[model samples]
Target: MAISKKNKSKVSVDGKEYLWWVFDEYDQTEFDGIQIKAVSSDQTHFIKYGLQQSLNNSKLVLALKNYTKLVHLSLPPKFENNEGVITKTGINRMIKWCKKDVHHIEYALDGSRNDLTEAEKQLLLKELQKIIR
Candidate 1:
């Protein structure tokens, strides 16, 4: 006669918090005690991993300095002054620091975007690399 054994329960690694993350989605990602970095509530950010600028812009700034030659793209004129309100927008524009730049790809994809000489694909690759490093 064979003795019946009890069914084994599934085990989760690093308990339920850390390991359980991969299968789930997070709205905000924390770093250095701050939730400043946002983790998309989707799979792409989870599946594809690396340094996202939302986590740290300094890293990308350093990468631009290292990989590309010296080039100063000035902040948009509208943002040149008025200190608090305009300066951030100006800086963000020059670096394409966040979604603002990426959002344009959608608009331009429809053919309304001017400045056709600068190809969208090329800009996408270049910006993606900057984000990666």
Candidate 2:
């Protein structure tokens, strides 16, 4: 939380809007993404959410759940990388960090190193956003 980058943005879900802050811990490395702090439009209170992984849509879901008093966390679809981001030897360690999500959105499973396209990423985000509402 000692980090000083004050990134903020507005997000709309279920016809309602919210404000969020992105900050990383002082000890956290650049590879680790920042945590999200968000609050509703009314500003009654705030929520600090950290999911311990990368992926924009998933992180957004974490924020929406913490910001509201309702049960939104269970709605966001969980995801996992079929083939590990690391080498075979380090695969298990990375998978452990993925937090037991499903691999519905397959990546690198077909023995190809192709990166995700912008359109594909947007489509996935759209699918995830659908559950947020």
Candidate 3:
């Protein structure tokens, strides 16, 4: 199901307007995770990132950082804590990553998905090794 327009937040990225929203997914009574979904003003491009944990501002920042690190992309700017809710800047960062050629493939407009690819896993392993060194 598509996110309702009333629930979505709007942001302008690089002179283009986009709409984004966070939705909770559930496994029956149990809570799954929250997915951040965004689409261009024209609706031609869509981005979705799922976090397999409960939502909060700190966790959202960490998830964005970890995802970018695994992809060998620069970490997104720190987000403001707006009462523990996701902020527009955080959504903007996701949109930026979505526009990149390398990262965009992982968040396909077609909706087929995986949390991480084997190559990304290996790269993250190497990064971890470097930090441990």
Query: Which numbered prediction scores highest in TM-score against the true structure?
Result: 3
Ranking by lDDT: 3, 2, 1
TM-score, ranked from best to worst: 3, 2, 1
Residue-level lDDT of model 2, residues 1-133, one tens digit each, is: 1223345566554454456555667455212444545555655434334434545444222222323221112222222234412222232222222223332332211113236554554444344334433
Between prediction 1 and prediction 3, the one with superior lDDT is: 3
C-alpha local distance difference test of each model: 0.25, 0.37, 0.48
Pairs that collide in candidate 1 are none
Candidate maximizing lDDT: 3
TM-score preference between candidates 1 and 2, better one = 2
Candidate 2 vs. true structure, TM-score:
0.31
Off by over 4 Å in 1: 1-63, 69-77, 82-99, 102-117, 124-133
How close is every model to the real structure, measured as TM-score? 0.21, 0.31, 0.47
Off by over 4 Å in 3: 1-4, 27-32, 52-84, 104-133
lDDT of 3 by residue, 79-131 (tens): 32445466888777665543443321222111233366656554443443233
